[model samples]
Target: MPKSLIASAEWSLLLSRLRALAPEAFDSQGRVLNLVAREWGNPGHGKPYLSPVDGSQLGLLPMIDLSTATHAVASAAAEAEEWARVDLDTRKARVSACLDLLHENHELLALLLTWEIGKPVPQSRVSVERCISGVKWYVENIESMMEGREPLGLISNIASWNYPMSVLMHAALVQALAGNAVIAKSPTDGGLLSLTLAMAFARRCGLPMSLVSGSGGKLSEALVRDPHIACLSFVGGKVNGRDIAASLYDRKKRYMLEMEGVNAYGIWRFSDWNQLAKQLKKGFEYGKQRCTAYPRFVVERGLVPRFLEMYLPMLTSLKVGHPLLGETRAAEPPSVDFGPLINSGKVEELHAMMSEAEAKGAIPLYKGRLEPNLFLPNQDVSAYLGPCAFLHVPRNCRLYHNEPFGPVDSIVVVDTEEELVTEMNVSNGALVASLACDEPETARRIASELRAFKVGINTTRSRGDREESFGGIGQSWQGCFVGGAYLVQAVTEGPPGERLFGNFPDYTLLPEKR
Candidate 1:
C-alpha cells in the first residue's frame, strides 16, 4: 500500500486535530466520513473519496438509503421552524460567532481544501478569507435586508465542488441569516471539508440545518422533490440545473439556478497588454475550474499578435505541481500559479478538447507539458496538466462554443467592435465578461451592450464587491440575481408588512416637543 500523503509532521498534526473533532471521519489509515448512513454496517457498499492532488484514497463516503435521507430533510425542516422563532438579533450573534470560529480554524480548512480539491494552500487560504468576509458582510447587513421580507421556510441549497468553501457556504450562510433553515448537499468530490465547515457552523452557532454527502443522484432528487422545502438554490452544470428548474416549476416551488456558461474576455487595441496579461492569468488560477473563469478570449485584429506574445509566455510560466508543496506568497505566487485539475479523467478530457481544437485548424500557441517534479515515484500523476493555449480557433469548433472547464484557452481575433460584440454574445449568454480598453466611452458602450450580469472594465477577475448584486442573463441564470441585498430577498418571501417588525415605523421625537 502507498504511504499516506499526510506523512509530513505538520500535515500529520493537522490531521490529528481534525480527527479529534470528528473521530468517526478522520483516521491514520484514512479519513472516512459516514455521509449516507450514520453507521457503516456494510463496508463494501461505501464509495472511495480520492484526493485530486495525489490520486490517493482519502476516505470512504457511505451511500445512505432513501429513508435515511428523507429523515435528514424532515429533521432539517423541523429545526428550521424552531429557528425561525429565535430573535433576529440572537441569530445574528450566532452567525457572528460562527464566522469567528471559521477564522480561528482557517489553517485547518485551508489544508483540507488543498488536499481535497487540489487548490494550492495560498489560494485555499484566500478562499477561506473570502468566506469569512462574505459571512461578515451578510451578518452585518442582515437586519436591513431582512427587514422587508419573511423567511422562506426551508432552503434546499445544492453546491458545486469547484469552490466548496466560499461559493457554496456563502449562499448557505446568507439563507441562515435571513431566518430560513437550510438543507445543504455538498458535492461528493469535496464533501469532507464542506461537511467539516457546516458542522463547525452548527456547533458554534447552535443553528438548525442538515449538511449531507452523496453523489447528487437519488438523494438530491429526493431533496428537490420534497414538498416541504420552500426554495431550491443550485450552483452547477447547465444540464443538471435545467433538470432542477423543471422539477421546481412542476412543484410550484421558488428556485435560483446558477448554471455554467462559456464566459469571454475582450481586448481592444488600446488596452495595456502587460497589465492585462497579469490580470488574465486569473482565468486559469484554479485550472479554469471556476464558472466565472474566462475560457474564450476575443482580441481585436490589430492587437492579437501583441496580446499572444505577452499572454502565452505568462501562461507557459505557470507552475503545475502538488498543491501542498507549492511555494506560498503574500499575494499571488510568482513561481507557482496553479495546481492540478480535479482528477485524472478531467485531465484526459481537457487534453482531448485541445487535440480536437488543434485538429480543426486551431493554432497551438503553447501546448503545455507536465513537469517531472509534479509526480512521485509509483504515484499516479494523471490529475496534473500544465496550462494550454490556442489561437485562431474556428468559429464552428465545439471548443469555441463550449465551456472548457479546465486550463485551456482559445483566442479569436475580431476586426470591429460589432464583430467583437457578436463573438462575445456567440455563447448565447454568460455569467460575466471583462473588457480591456483605454477609453471610458468605449468601455461604457461595451458594458451597455453586454448580455452578462456583471462587466469588468480593464480587469479579468470575475468576482465583484461583496455588496454588489451578481447573476447572469438568458441561459446563464434563472429566477433572480444573487449577492448583496438581492440574496437576502431571494431566500425569503412576502413583503415588509408580513415580517415580524415590518409594520413598525422608526422611532422619532416630535418637532414641536424639540
Candidate 2:
C-alpha cells in the first residue's frame, strides 16, 4: 500500500475502533484525528518509522499525511470554550462517565497503547489502570476543591510518550472536573493514544469535537501562544519545558511541569538489605526509561561491600526479555531489560556517555550494546540495545554529576548524608532524588537537607500520584506543578479578568470556626 493510503487507512481504523469501543462518541459524531503521527513522517513501506518492543516494525501512520495540525488546535480550543461554559454538575457527570467508559474499554485501550507507543503490553496495562485511578480520584474530590466555582479560565495539558494516555488523560480529566477549559497536546511519539481518548470524550459526553485537538508542528505552537490558554501543564524533557516556560513567563501563565529528572537512589541505609537488593533488581524493570527511574545510586562507605554483596547478584538474575512477559520494571530478553532509546540518536548519545565515563575510570558492572547493522530488511525485529552497565564512579566525577536517563545507573560512595546532598546538588538538575537508608534519622536528615523538588524514601519514585505536586526546583522546570488542587488553580484561579460584577470576595472575614 502507498504510504499516504496507509496513513489514511490507519486513521480510519482508529476511528472505527474508537467508535466500537465508545459507541456514545460515535453516536455523537465525535471522531479523533491521530494528528502527530501524520506530521512526523511517511509510512506504509512495511518498514515502520517506529520500532515495536519485539524488534518488529512499529507500523504506525505518519504525522505529515494528517490534516493540518492548526485545525486540531482550533477544534480543541472551541471544545474548551464550550466545556467551560457548561454547568459544573453537568461537567462532573461527563467526567465521571468518562472514567466508567475508560474502565469498560480498558483492554482495547491497552492494546492500542502498545501498538501506538511501542511500550510492552504489561506496562500498557499499568498505564490503563493508572489512568482510570487518576480519573476516579478527580471525580471523588473535584467538588470539595471547587468551593468558590470561579473558573481558572484556561488550563493546558502537555503530555509525554512513555505513558501518554494515563498522564494526559488523568491530568486533563482533573482539570475538566474542576470546570476549566483545558487545551491539551500529546507528544510526537504518542499522539495516537491522546487523540483516540479525545474522540471518546466527544462521543460519550456530547462534548464539542474541538475540545481535544491532536495536530503537530505550527498547530502546537499556535495552541501554546493562544492567549486563552492561561494555565500550562507539561511533561517532557527539561529543555523544551523550559522553552515553554520562557514563552509563558511574561504572560504569567499558571503552569505545572513534570520535567525530566536524572533521579538517583541512595543505598546509604536500608530497612532490610535483602529487600533493598530485590527491589533495586526490579528497579531497572522499565528499561530504566522512565523519568523517575533510579539512574544513580549513592552507597555509604561502610554499606558498599555488604550492599553489593547482595545487590549485584540480584541484578544479574533479572529476566531481560519481552515486556509482555511480566517484566514491568525493566526490559527483559526477547525484550531485554529495556528497549532501545527513543531513537538511534539517543542510542549514540548514550553510548558516547558510557564511553566517556569508562575513559574517566568508571567501572562498568553490566556493559550495554547494540549491533551495528541490525535494521536489515527482513530481520523481523526493531532495535534492541540491552541494559547498559551499572558503573561505579568517584563521588565528584562527571559521571556522578549527570543524570543517566536510560538503564545506566552510576554508584557513588558517601560517608555522610551531608556529602550525598552536596554531590547530588553537584548537577544543575534538581528534579528528584531518592533515599534508601535503613535508619529513620538518616532518611529524615537527608529529606530535610536535600535540594530536590521531590524525594523518594526507600523506594523508586514515580510522577503518577495525584495528591503530590510533581515538579522540580532550579533547572528542572519553569515553576509549573501538577497534582492536588493545582490543576484547578492552574485553570480557574488566575489573575482577575475584566471587572464584571461586585468587588472580589471579602478578605478580612470574621472569627474562626474553631
Candidate 3:
C-alpha cells in the first residue's frame, strides 16, 4: 500500500504549535487574521469557514476593512514602478525561487487544501504541481510574449474557490513576469490557507505581502474602480464577472474575465463507447465543481441505449466518502471518487435543480442517493450528493441550459450531425465542447459550428498544455484568454505600432481623394 498523504505526527505537532502561538493568525470560531505587509490584523466581522468534509465549522475568515484595503492597493500601486524597473533576469529568478519554495512546502499546502476545500489529497497535490508548472511556464515564455509591450501597472487578480491556488498562482506569476505589480483578492470561500501561503512565499522573494492580500466585497469593488489598477483578472461566476466588466468599461481598464460555462460533449454513432466512457467519467472529478466539466452530453439517437448501458453503471458505482481517507486503511473504504459539495447549500441547490428537471418531464435514468453511512464517524453526510444520470431531458428544462455545477448529468439525444451541433450550441456560452466522432470531416464541421473557445475531438477534459490559450467566447468570457501567450498581452499595454513587426502602409496614406 502507498504511504498516507496526511501529515505525520511531527508535522501536525508543529502546525498546532504555530497555531497556538498566533491563534489570531488562524481562523477560529468567528475571528480571522488578515495579512497585510506581514502584519496580521483582525477586522472583527467575519464569515464562518465550514468543512465540506463533515459540515463542521472550521473557523472564521476575516474580512478586510475598506480603508485598510485601499491603503494596501496604494502600496501596491507605489511598488509597481519599482518592480517594473527591475531587470527581467532578476524578476525571472525571483519567480523561479518562489516556485521552489512552493515545492518545498507542497505537503503542508496540499493538506491545508484538502481540509479547507474538501479536495482529495491526491488531487490537491496535483493542483500544487499545476501552480508550480504555471510559474515555470510564464517565466520561460515571458520574454517572447512581452517583446515590445509595456507593463500595465498594478493588476488586480480576483480568484475563485475551486482550484484557488492554481488560478491565483497562474494570474500572479504571468502578471508579475510582465513587470506588473499585483493585488490578488482571496475568494470568500476556501481561499484562506492557499492565498496566505502564497503571500508569504512571494514576500520572502522581496514582493510585499500587502500587494497580494486582502478580502471584502466593498474592498474588491474599490480595487476595481481604482484608477491605479490598470488591469483586472477575474475568475468567478458569470454574473459577477459581468458586473466587474461593466465597472471597468468606463474606466477603460484592461481586464480578463474567466467565467463559468455549461460545457457539452457529443457522442456519435461510430464513437468507441469504452473510450468515450473513460473520458466522460472526468466530468465527475471534484464532483463536477470544475468549470470545464461536461455537464451536457449530446448522444446520437441510435447510440443512446448502448451509451446509457455503459455510462449509468459507472456513475452509480462511484464512491462518495471522506476525501482524506486512504485506500490502504483496513478499517476504511477505498479512496473516494466523489466527495461532498463545497457546503450543504450546494447540495440543496443541486437537488433543487435535478428536481426541477424531473418535474419538467425529464426521465430519470439513475436517481442519486445520499448515504449517511458512507461518511466517517460524526461527519455530516447532508452535503454529500451521489452522482446522477438523466435522459430524455426536455429542451425547455432549466438543466438544458444552466450548468448544474454538481454531480448531475443530462443526456440529450439528436438524430443528425446538424441536430447534434445545434444542441451543443444551445448553451448561452461554453468554454469547450468535446466531440466523439470517428469521421474527421464530421468532427471538423461540429467544431467549427460550436460556439466555444476550445473543441476537443474524442477528449472530454480540458487540456493542460501551458502553450495553449484557455478562454471562452460570447458570455463565457468578457476579455482575452487567461493562459499561454495571451496572458502577457492581458496584463500589459503598448501602442499598436509596437505590436507590428514589419513596416506596413499607413492607413492615412490611402488615396487623399478618398
Q: lDDT values of the candidates? A: 0.72, 0.58, 0.72
Best by TM-score: 3
What tens digits encode model 3's per-residue C-alpha lDDT throughout 412-509? 89898888888888766688788888898877777778877778888764735477666676677776565676677767776674332111112111
Model 2 C-alpha lDDT per residue in residues 1-514, reported as the tens digit of each score: 1223223223336446666654532223242334221121122112133444444433333333223444555555555666677887887788777777777777667756655554555667688898888778777787776776566655666677677667776776777677665555546554454445544553446433323333433454655666556566777776676677677666755565666656666777664787677667667755666776777777788888887788667666644433333322222224334444454445567777778778778898876444423222344333344665555665555456666666666777789767787756665556667788768776877776665666777765566476765555556655535566655555565345622211111211111110
Task: Flag clash pairs in model 1.
Answer: 36-64
Q: After superposition, how far is residue 239 of candidate 2 from its true place, in Å?
A: 1.4
lDDT of 3 at 343: 81
Model 3: lDDT of residue 413? 93
lDDT over C-alpha atoms for residue 318 of model 3? 79
TM-score computed on alpha carbons, candidate 3? 0.90
| TM-score of model 1 vs. true structure | 0.88
| Native-to-model Cα distance after best TM-score fit, residue 259 in candidate 3, in Å | 1.4
Q: Is candidate 1 or candidate 2 better by TM-score?
A: 1
